[model samples]
Target: MPPKLPPHTADALFFCPSCSTWRRSFTNTNTTNLLRRAHQRRRPASTLAASSHPSPASPTVNGARNVPERFRELYAALQGVRDVAANHVNMSRLQLALRGLEGEKGIVRVAVLGLDNTATTARLVRLLLADPLSEKAEWEDYLQTYRMESSRGLLIRYGEQTNLAVGNSLVPTISIPSRALKTGNLEILVSSLGARSISADQTIASDALLVPTIAIQSTSTGAHSFVRYPVHKSMVCGKGVNGLLAYTGLVGRVNPNTADSIRAAFELNVGEGATPEGNDGISFVDIERAETALDMFRESVQNATEYEKGWTGSGVQPLVDWISSPAKDVAIDPAIKRLVDSTLDGAEKSIVSEEKRKVLALEANTVPEEVRMALHETVSAWAERAHTELRDSLDQGFASKPWRTLAWWKLFWHVDDVGMITSRILRRKWLPEAEKEVVWMGGKIHQAGLLNQETNSTNPIQNSTEFEISEEKSSTFSRNLWPTQIPDTRKQLTTSSVPSLHRFAQNLVMFSLSTTSLSSALSALVYVSTSTTSVYEAGTIATIGLFYSLRRQQKQWDAARGFWEREVREEGRQALKETENVLRSVIHEGGRGIETAPETEARQQIDRARQALSNVK
Candidate 1:
C-alpha cells in the first residue's frame, strides 16, 4: 500500500489481488463447455436424446416386472410336458381327435334288434332312411345323392338277406373305398344285427345297438300284444336303455290279459317304470306319423345333444348321437385325459431312459478287465514257452555230435536249428493257440453285435499261413494286431537271423582253413630252409602247429556258435514279447470295437428323440 505510486496500478492492486486465480477458473469453465459441445457433436441426435431420457427397464429383463417369485416351478412343469409329447399312444389319440375335428370319414356301425319279423325290421330300416322333407319324386334323387356320398350313407347288414348269419365267425362288414384307408385316415361303416342274434351274451362290432323294434301284432280278440327282446350287455354303453320308442297306433287295441305280461317284459328288458303310463317312456305312431320322430333323431345326431333325464323317445336319437359324438368328447374324458397324459409322459421318459441305458451298455467295453488280464497272461505264457523251446533247441543244436557241428556245408542251404525251432514254435504252437483265443474273443464280440463285419469277414487269424505268404498280402489282408506284424516279425526273427548266422559260421570255417593252409606253407618253407632240422623234429613241430591251429579254430567256432545262439534266443524272446504286447492291444481295441456302430446309432436315436421332445414341448 505504501509502495503504490501510479493511480492505475493502485486501482489494479485494490480491485483484483487474485486476478490469476479468477482467470484460471474462467479458463477451466470455458474448456469444460468446449468438451461438452464436442461430445454432443460426436453423438447422433437420437443417441443424445436417448441418453438424456433413459429408457425404462424391460419386463423380462432380470424378471423386473410381472414375474412370479416361483417362476422356476413353471419351467419344471414344462420339462414333464416334453415327456408326455414323446408318447406315441398319446400322439395317436391327439391325431385321431384332430382328424375328427377335420370331419374325416370314420366307421359308425349300428345293430338293430327286438323285432321277430324280418319284414317289419326291413320296413323300419326304410322308414329310418326316408327323409321327411323329401317328396316322392325326389326319392330316387336323394337315394342317388346318399349313394354317391357313402360317408353319410348307411349299409344294412340284415340277417338272411345279406347272409349275415347269427353266431358267424366273420362279422359282416361293408368295404369302403381304398382311398379312405390312407395312412392316418378312416372311413364310415354303418351296419345292423338281426333280432334272432339278440341274446344276453350276443356280441357285435356295432358302435350302437337298436332294440325293441317296431312291429304290428295280430291277436284273435282284435287286440295287440308287444313282444320285448333282451338287449345284450356288451352293446349297451351305459346303464339302462338309451332311449325307447313305443308303437302308439295300436295303443287302444291292447289286450287287457297280456297287458301285465307286456309291461313285465318291458321292465325286465329295459328298466323298471319304462311304460307309456309312466313318465319315463316316449311313444310314437307307426308309418308316416314316425317321420317327425326320425327327423328329430337325425337332428340330435348332427347336433350331438345330450339326452334329457326321465325323457324317453325312439332309441334312434340317443344311439345315433352316441355313435356320431366326436372322439375327444366321448372317448377323452377330463379325468381320463389327465391320466393318459401323465401315463404318456411317464412312458416317453421311460423310453428315453431305456434307450439311453442301452446306449450306455453298448458303449461299455465288451471284454471284462479280468478276461483281458487273463488273455495277457496267456500270451505271456505262450511267449515264455516259445522262449524256453528256442533256448532248448539252440542248446541241443550246439551240444550235438561233432560231425553235425562241423557240417558247415549244410549252412549254405539248410536252416539253422534256432530258426527252425523259432518258426515251428511261432507258426504251429504260439500262433495257432493265440489265434484261437483271439478268434474266440472276436466271436464273443460278434455275438454282442459289436464286431465290424468287414474285419470279421476278412480276419487273417483263421488262415495262419496267410500271414507268412507275402508281406504285401499280409498288410492288405491283416487288420488284427497279432497277424498284421507276424509276417515281418517272423521274417526278422527266423529268415533274416538264420541266414546271417549261417554266413558268420561259413566265414569262420573259411578263415580257419586259410590259417591252416598258411601255417602249413610256412612250416614247409622253414623245414626246407633249415640245414640242422631233423625229419622227426620237423614232423613234431608241424604236428604241434597243426594241433594249436585246430585248437584256436575250435575256440573261435565255439565262441561264434555261442554268440549266434545268444543272439537268436534274445531275438526270439524280444519277438515274443512284442507279439504278446500286440495281442494285448488287440484284445483291448477289439473289446471297445464290439457293437460300436450299434451303440453310436442308439445314442444318435436318443438325441433325435430328445430333440423332437424338446420341439414338441
Candidate 2:
C-alpha cells in the first residue's frame, strides 16, 4: 500500500518482556567484546585455538553478539574458588590449638557431675550424640577406645562403690564425685608421684588419653585443649528431661529466630523489584528489534495518507466511514481497506464485555437531585492510591528471594549427654521423617533407667519383681493368679526365658513378610502363629522332660528343680530366699504335697508342678 515499505526498516521498540525496561547500551561493541573475552579463557587451549569465528558476511543486525568459547567453564571455575574462600573465613581458633594438646594432654577423665545413675548417664550421653551434624561419632569412638585403657590407673569412687573395675564402670566409677573439687590433695598425690597437674574441680586430669579414631586436628580441638563437638541446645531442654537438659535446649533456637527476622526484613526491602529481570534492563538486541518494527509500521501509514489517491465506484460508504469522509482524507488500497476493516471488527468482537472501557456522564437536560447525589458519593468513596500501594506490597511478598546464611551449632558442657550439633542438622534438615526413630530410641533409654532405678531401691517387692525369684505360690505369681488358683512357678520361669526366642522369631517374621497389597502384617502374623506352634510344642517337650525318664511325674519335679537352679544363678540369694518364703507361706495356707500312692502320687505331683510353674522367677 505504501510502496511496500523499506525491507531493512522494522519495529524497534527496545522493550523487554521480563523486566519491562528499555535496554540500549548493552548492544554496544565494547560490552560485547568484554563478555566474549571472559568466556574464552575457560576453554582448553586446544579447543580455544581450534574454534571457528563467525563469517563477516553474516552480520548481527541489532545489539546481539555471538557468545565466546568456554564462558560456562570459566564461570564454574570461579564458583569453586569462591567456595574455597568461604571455607577459609569460617576456620576457628580451636583448629590452630589442637596440635599442642594431642597424645597425653588431651586424655582427661570426664566426670559427669549430676549423672548419679548409670541409666540416666547412658541416656544423656546417647541423646547428646543423637544429632547428625555433631561430632558425635568422633566422641563416641573416643570413649569406646579409651574404655579399655582407663581401668588400670583409675580408682572410681562414687555412690557407695569405691575402686570399681573399669569394665563394670558406672557414671561415678571413674573418679570420686567430691575429690575433684578438693584438687590440692589429689594434685599433690599425683604431683608427688611426678604426674602432670591436670585435675580441676569436677574434672580429673589424666595422662591416660581418650583418643577418637577419626580426630582431625581442626575439628576436634578446643581452647581447653579438649576435644570439642557441635551440639544443639534445644535437645537438652526438650520434653521429659530436666536440669542440664533444659539449659542445653537453647542452642538451636538462636539461629531460628534470627533467620525469621532476616526473612521478614528482606520481604519489606525487596518486595516487587526482587527478580534480576524485573530490576535490571533487558538485552540490547531485543529492545532495538521491537522499537524498529513499531516505527516502520507507523511511517508506512503516514506515507500512504499523503501520497495515495483512489476512487471506488461501489456504494459502500456507510460500511467505510473513514473512506467516505474527505475531512479525514486518507487513501488505502481496496484490498488493504478490506483487510483493516475485517481485522478491527474481529478484534472488537473478541474483546470481553468486562474489558470494555466505560465513562460516567450526566444525562443531558436531566437535573435530577438523586442522580447528582449518587455521582458525588461514588467519587468520594474510591481509594485510588491506597489500592495501588496494597497491590504492590502483595506482589513483592510472593516474589521472595532465596536466603543465604551461615550455619551455627551450639555447644554444651556435657558433651556425652548433649552429643554434637551435626546430629541436630540431620534430624531437622536431612531426615525429618526419622524424628520418631530418635524419640523412640530415647524412650528405650528412659525405660532402661526406670528398670535400673527400681533395682537400686530398698523396697523388697519392687526389687524381687524387677529382678526374678523362683518358688511355687510366690507373691509375684499371686498378682496374676486367682485367689483359689494354685501357682506354677516353674512354668512362669520357663515362659520368661522364652521371651528372647519369641523376640527373635518376631523380628524374623516381620522382616520376611513382603509389604505388597496382597501380603499384610496381619496375614504374616497368622502365618507365624501357624508355623511357630510346632516350635513351642518342641520347647515344652524338651524343657519339661529332657534327661528325666519319660515318666510325667519325674518330668514335672525335674522342671521345677531346673527352674529353681536357674533363678538362684541369675538372681542370687535374696531372690531365692523370697521364693522360699512364698513357697512355705503357701504350704502353711493348705497347699498339698505329692502322695506315695501311684495314681494319687502322680496327680499330687502334677498339682505341685503346676504350682511351681506359676511361681517362677
Candidate 3:
C-alpha cells in the first residue's frame, strides 16, 4: 500500500483520480502520481466511448448469442429487468444449452411454427434430441428459475414459475397429450388472411416477445424426428385475442429501467428527491401479490414430469404459428375416403349422411353407381363429425389454452408487488451514471461535478468533467436510470437492472436498523390515535417525537455508511490495481520525462569506467 498521508482538509473532497472515488483525503504523492497516470492512460475520445461506464466489455443485449435482434427488443421493452439477466431463450445458444441439458440419446421436441421448416427443423430437432442426461444450470438461470428457494416467501412468490426443471431432465416416454398436439392453438394476427399473408401488425411483431418465442414439449416417441405440420385455419386478432397478448405484454414489462418507469405506468405522483414517508417514494398499498390464476394449471404440469416443459417459457411463438396455418376446411380429405368408409361401415354408432354423401361422392363412371353410393355415405358421416369437433374448440383454442400454457406467464406472477421488493434492494443504493464523453450537456445533471468540491466559477459546472453517478439520497429507496437498459445492479452497472433483489435490499436495511428505535415510533403512532388518559396520551406523543428524531438520525447515518462502504468496495484498495495500470501507462507512453536520478547516476558510472580503463591502458 502507498503510505497513507493525512488529507490537507479534515474532509478533503477530491475524486480519487486513480480509483474513481470522492476521497476525504489523498496521499499527496499518490494523488499526483494517480492524476499523472490517469491523464496518460486516457484514450482518444473515439476509442474510449464507454470508458466512463464500468465493465464496458460485457455484451449489451445480454440474452443468448446469435438469436435474432427481436429478443433484444423484447428485453428492451421490459420494465425492471436489465440486460444482465435477459438471456434469449430460443436463440442458437439456447438450443446448444438444451442439447447439453438433454445429453445423449434424448428426444425432446420444441415447436416453432413457420420458422421450423424442411431443413432447419430436422437440424434443430437433432440438436436438442442428442442429449438428455447432461445437466446445465445456465439454461435454467437464463430461461427460468429451476431451483426452489427454501424460504417460503420466495417459494410462494415464484412457485408456479419456478417448479419446472426444464433444464435438467428429458424423458422421451413422457406422454404429450394428443389434443395438445392438434388443437387449442390460435394465430395472433387478424389480417392473416391465409398461410402466406405477411400483413400482421409490425409493432406487435417487434415488441411482443412471443413472435419468435419457442414452445418446448416432451414427447413419448422413441424416434427423434421433427414434424412440420401444415398451419390451421382459424386466424384471429382483436380484443378476443387480448388475453394472451395481455400476458405477453406483461412479460415485456417485467424488467424495468427504474422505479419511475413503474410509477409512471401507475400514475403515482411522488416528489423526485423528497424524503420518503408513509407510502411515499416507492411505497405500496399491498404487501403480497397472490396471482394464482394459473395455480391449477401449473400444479398439474409440475406433477406429471417433476420438471417443467420447455413450452412454458416462450411457447407463444409456436402456439401462434400452429394456429396461423390455413384451416383444413374439409375434415376428411376426399383422398382418404376409402379409409373412412371402411372403418365406419359396421359400427352401430355410425350413421351415414346420405344427402351430404352424394354431394361429396367422387364421380366414378367406371364403378357401378349403386356401389359408389354405399362408399360415399360412410365417408360423409365421418366428415360431418370431424367438422363439429373443429367448430366446438373455437373458444377453447383462443382462450383456455393460453391460460394453461404459453400465455399463462403474464398472469402467473404479479409484478406490481415486485416494486416493493425493488424498494428494498435499491434502498439508498448509488449507481454510476451513463458512460458518455465528458461533455457539457444541457439539462442533464452533471454527476461528476457534484463530487468535485473545489469548483471553479469559470467552469460554471458546464465545462465540469466528471463521471455520472445515480446517487440515491432518499430516506428510502428511489432513483431513475436510462429507461430500460439494465445491467447487474450489484456493482457499477451500465444497463442490466436486477429488480429481483428488491426484497433483499429491504431486508438488509431493516436488519441494520435498531429495533428499539422502530418499536418506539410504532407504539407512538398506534397509541396516539386513542388514549386511556391525558398523561398517557402526552407520554405517547413525547415518544413519537423522540423516535422520529432518532429515526431521522438513523437515516443520515445509513446514507453516510452506505457511501463509505461503496467507496471502499468500489474504489479503495480494489482501485489500486486499476491505478497501477494507469501508472504503467504513464511510464510507457510517449515522452515520460526521463528518470534523471537513475539516468544521471548511470552516466557518472560510465564516465568513471572510462577513466579506470585509461589507467589500465
Highest lDDT, which number?
A: 1
Candidate 1 segments exceeding 4 Å error: 1-269, 272-397, 400-494, 519-559, 578-617
lDDT of 1 by residue, 81-113 (tens): 333434422332222222122122222223333
- C-alpha TM-score for every candidate: 0.37, 0.12, 0.14
Residue pairs with colliding backbones in model 1 are 106-187, 106-188, 107-189, 450-594, 450-595
Top-TM-score candidate index: 1
Sort order, TM-score high to low: 1, 3, 2
Question: In model 3, which runs have C-alpha deviations exceeding 4 angstroms?
Answer: 1-532, 535-617
Candidate RMSDs in order: 29.4, 50.1, 46.7
Q: Backbone clashes in each candidate structure, one number apiece?
A: 5, 56, 38
Model 2, 395-418: lDDT tens digits are: 332232210010101111122212
Q: Give the candidates in order of lDDT, highest first.
A: 1, 3, 2
Task: Looking at model 1, report the run of 10 residues with the lowest lDDT sum.
Answer: 15-24
Q: Model 1 — TM-score against the truth?
A: 0.37
**What is the model-wide C-alpha lDDT for candidate 1?**
0.36
The regions of model 2 sitting more than 4 angstroms off are 1-84, 87-89, 92-121, 124-224, 228-241, 257-617
